[model samples]
Target chain A: MEYVVQTTNLSKRFGKESAVIGLDMKIRKGEIYGFLGPNGAGKTTTIRMLLGLMKASSGTIQIFEKDLNKEKINILKRVGSLVENPSYYPHLTAYENLEALRKILGVPKTRIHEVLEIVRLTEVANKKVKGFSLGMKQRLGIAASLLNSPELLILDEPTNGLDPSGIIEIRNLIKQLPAETGMTILISSHLLTEIDQMATTVGIVTKGKMIYQDSIESLRMYAQQKVLLKVSDSEQAWRSLLGNGIKADWEDGIILLSEHSDGKVAKAIHTLVHEGYSIYRVEEEKRSLEDIFLQMTTREKVI
Target chain B: MIGKLLRADFLKIKRKGLWFLSFLGPFGVIALQMVNYGVRKDYLLNQSDDDWGYFLEYVHSFTPLALVLGIAILTSFMASIENETNAWKQLISLPVSKMSVYLSKFMVLGSLLFVSSLLLGVFSLGYGILLNLGDQIPYLELLKYSFYPYLAALPILALQLWIASVSQNQGIPITTGVLGVIFAYSAFILPDWMIWKWPSLMNEWDEPLINVMLGIGVGTLLYIVGMLDFTRRDVK
Candidate 1:
């Protein structure tokens, strides 16, 4: 299937308030699609709908090229997911916890060892999950979702509770998923940097509306790149650049011109020196994924 | 699917005190008589011509209350296990239907209650032998006293299980369970149609089999209603 998940005008309302409205999501096969949204931006609600855990008020969901409502069991069999925080039987051993799910999944018994090994919990497999740390629990949750060897893995905030290094590890693991196995992943997160490194395609949502959905390259194009000019004559450089039809602003005794092309930069420099401006240093300021994400989600339209 | 779910549910509650509670219900019912016989055997023995009948009547008195309370606890415990682990979403997202999930829970509760009812039979007979109430033990009456209350308590079991399964706050089911226990305690005043009264076999008709039939029929109906409600709604 070209798209692992497709939805049109999906909406979910709780009484008078709408949790998610008019959401159109398209997630392609073999791509790590980042479902980006701020906290309470209806990320979890959308994921729940795709998994059939919650029924949509009005919408259609197709997964694995099959209608979700019609082929729920068959479609779900190839989809593995971990929603929000990982839920586990605290009293049961880690191995036993997966064993419980494995029985329900009707997978092979050895699948328990495989998942435990994949998440690197082999040594502690027999230990009760009550003692596991947050990162370990998240990993175990990932392990549980992979027990069926699903083709599409949907994880909601998988790294929500992890530390910086644990976050990096999970990000790398997600990045390696497509090469290791031809599986598509839909990972939802509020952290733009987390998604930037892990996702091939990004969907930015705010207040139940998707502000932007495209490839990472297209999302990066929205970022506002600038050239920082540290010149002795900051005022002269600003005026000269403005006269050249380039918008220039002064910040901390420097002139910043927005995304002037290489040719324009040379011309702007030539004009600066012609205006008797002493250029001490020039630095290119690349807009971060965080900047682009904030601009797209917070503004009325993606700027 | 139901069988697999039942096995999984059983494994989840392996060391969680539910099994001990199941044993306690039957053992407690028999232990109360142990004290009665130890203290005043003569008074209890002189009441009826048939010693077995008198002992059975006394045993039956405690069975209804214990069975009703046990149903409440078992159903609540089963639901709480899933709630505490937050396993409902994971279970429903599997390649199984929600109806199977409901049936699995009911079957697990039904199986545990069955075991407890069987234990009641064993404990009641062992104690009756120990009392030397009589060599002529009315095996049929003893059997009825042990299992009849279980069968007749089905409607209450189904009702409590339904309440427990859908309720997010355990207190709601517990409250309903407490009211059921109180009503079962006063079954003498309750109407025949009341599920609580069916367990006590206290109806105007005075036929135990009629109550059993009603329990099974009404119990099945409630189970279907609860299952339909559960399958139609989103799992929280």
Candidate 2:
């Protein structure tokens, strides 16, 4: 895979406490990589290290296959980032704010208007940012990140403090970038649902460590629903199902079936009916991604 | 890159009142003299055989204090512009090197102080002509007095920028600046090695040129140290 961003054993320490420890992040080209963690999970710290805003205590970061320490300026040329809070000069107008960065990026003045229109701030382009709402400021930050037409964009909590509609707008925007422009994105958020909706690749971190890194589908596999059977004489039914080579678990007077395919569930039901057990109820119980995310982060176990 | 950064920085400070402060520092220094000459024109004129020299001396006395306080406020204001929004992280993330960012800030502040000094020279000469402090205008002396304090104050400018850039709290630099104004006010009693005393252009050798040379050399050294320190740390 052609990775847009890769890190090896990245770590950062402030005095005796480690903020980020042994993080190996791989962000592939043209994929929205979701960096998911709870608050204070060192998401911002790792993003800072990636952007060269903060030095890593120990590790190597390679962007575009070049060493970050030696080629930071060159690497950053193709990368755009918005870390932590949205950074802006409230005194400057929205156009002026992007113009300030556009000057540094050396992009055309027309590019500024394009990004403003992308963020839907064209009407307020001439107004000072101090009076802007949180969502407007966030859109401005996103607009600034896109000013360079970067190949790789990193945003920390991009939807933070936005209303539901605004969140959906940003989420759709992020989802479209990889397809529309072939841009690789690394978006960090504390909400698992947000990541679930946007990221193709997911990396879960908690307390300075990455516990889960894989495709979003694999993470969802952990959240797959299971078949639950409630029947009279459940103990006998469980043994009977076990003797038939079905993997099952009996807990609290209920039979739990992990292999919950339609054929397996139908066969189990048929077998239970044949064994003369009265089937009272059969239902599927779902494990949401939030549960899996909470378990992974709180347990600090690699999956 | 430095040029672009400078242009962007100049744009950032447009409504910040920095330009007014730059113009005001020199005008206030000359305005103090206006009040002095306005009150006792005849009495002050009788005190010195070199009337123009005496007027320039009185003007020079307040120059160091005004320069020191001005440097404090201006440098702090420049730093707060970035620190206000925590824009350092965003700025450092740019393709430009952190060294260039520091250099741009130093250059901007340096340019502002230079303009203020130029205005002081002009204002002093205009008021001197109005006072009729003799036909021998002492143009060289006027130039020396107006520009020397600014040159001698370079080290203080560099030191304040260093402190203001690194400090998260504006109060720290402001407090240091207050102490600096005190030192400049009592310049005669201060030791020669003090950065604050350099602005007064005083030393045991009694050569204003010595202070100018020390300001340039030490100012450059302090600037390098500050830039190195700024680039070494994390943006937050």
Candidate 3:
């Protein structure tokens, strides 16, 4: 139960707007922790705080068992980061960009070649980044982050601006990092689907608050999967479905039993059809990360 | 770590292509003298010792002005290079203290400009030597003449570095630096005895006695303040 990063009551304020409010987070060692929330939900702000890029308006941050504010240099020596868009000198070659970062981090030159290989940028390493596509630039950024062989890596929207294939490549790369190097990763994105495949644990935030945090498997079981019901008699069917100990919500005349399985839904549907209801539709709907994310945040926004 | 930072700073400074201005400054001084010497070639050769001395003094006077402008432009460009590259974010994230980060660039730009001014002084002195007037002109005396004014101009160099470090927009630092030089020039117009004040000392151009003490005090004050302001201020 060793946590690589822990933030207790961390909050940040920009004049009047509270970008992050009382955010308490825990990211265990060797785990890929996904931070999922909508735009402006404080995901980037939290990451900035953790990296010591921005100071917290209040609260404590601990990185690898060291107090972040007090031991920032020592803590940062073991952590690497890419927050927001990857910034580099457009005129510099990919190798030059990494070289500059290597110098600042005081990493050995050999590590530069190793990271370029890791990010699969060895072929284009000598090419100026100005001509590189967004995906190539992103890979170069990831390569720079890995130059120090850090114990923890924090990335904000790491796959952003990449094509589908590029996304898959980065996803696979992120998936392999922990297994191969024993690095803990904190990936923040507004898109849950992006993190669903890689992250071991997920923290779902809405309106700057952590609404849910759990293992990915538990989150899938308790929050994501839905028992979708397409029933006959679209009007009275809803009433009877609700009446017969079936708790369901309406969407385009399809009843949604959230976080439920097929057998539970089947029993409810059979009861409705047995009661002389003209059942036109009945099928179990598979919920996606997008669906879960939309449901959680939309509900929070409404409240 | 500081050495790494210095290398990165040098790479960035060299990439901006600003060293051309340093060459341009001394070259401009020689060019102007060449044109003037050509226009008055016959009259300048027939002049008396006092008149030749006046021409030599004019060359010496104009050289410092060109040198100051060079220092101002070079300083502004180097300090603002960080804003252009977004290098401040990356550089500041390093384990070093923020003061060293700001001062290192300041020192680099200051040293480059100081060297350029020294070169321009020698170049201007050589231009004077070429006039070939009938008087015994002391070559070593002329070199010492150029060095003296450079010492006095050291405070102006510190002032430019301060402006450059705190300003993000290149225009602001350059504008402030130009105006500062103008102010220093006006201060030097007063009698020499009345010129030991900070602004006046910036243009006091020949008293080694006054130059060394005021140069140390003013340069140290500006460097300390500039570093403090930079390290303490937030980077946008």
Highest-scoring model, TM-score: 2
For B1-236, candidate 1 gives per-residue lDDT tens digits of 78888889889887788899999999999999888877999998888888888888888898999999999899898888888868888888888899998999998889899999999999989999988877887888878888888888888888888888888899999999999999999999988888999988767988998888888899999999998988888877
Cα lDDT of model 2 by residue, B1-236, tens digit: 99999998898887999999999999999999999999999999999999999998999889999999999999999999899999989989999999999999999999999999999999999998999998998888888887888888888988999999999888999999999999999999999999899888889999999999998999999999999999998889
Instruction: List the DockQ of the predictions in order.
Output: 0.70, 0.85, 0.36
Q: Tell me the lDDT of model 2 at A248.
A: 92
True contacts kept of each: 0.66, 0.80, 0.27
* Clashes in predicted model 1: 0
lDDT of each: 0.88, 0.93, 0.74
Question: Which lDDT tens digits does candidate 1 get at residues A217-288?
Answer: 888765768888999868767877898787778887889877579987888788888888888998998877
The local lDDT score (0 to 100) that residue A270 gets in candidate 1 is 86
The collision pairs in model 3 are A230-A281, A232-A279, A232-A280
Query: What TM-score, computed on C-alpha atoms, does each candidate reach?
Result: 0.91, 0.94, 0.81
Docking class of 2: high
lDDT of 2 by residue, A142-233 (tens): 99999999999999999999999999999999998889999999999999999999999999989999888999999888788999999999
Candidate 2 vs. true structure, TM-score: 0.94
Runs off by more than 4 Å, candidate 3: A224-287, A298-303, B41-56, B128-168, B181-212
Q: For model 2, state the Cα shift of residue A129 in Å.
A: 0.9
Report how closely model 3 matches the true complex, as a DockQ value. 0.36
Which model, 1 or 3, shows the larger DockQ?
1
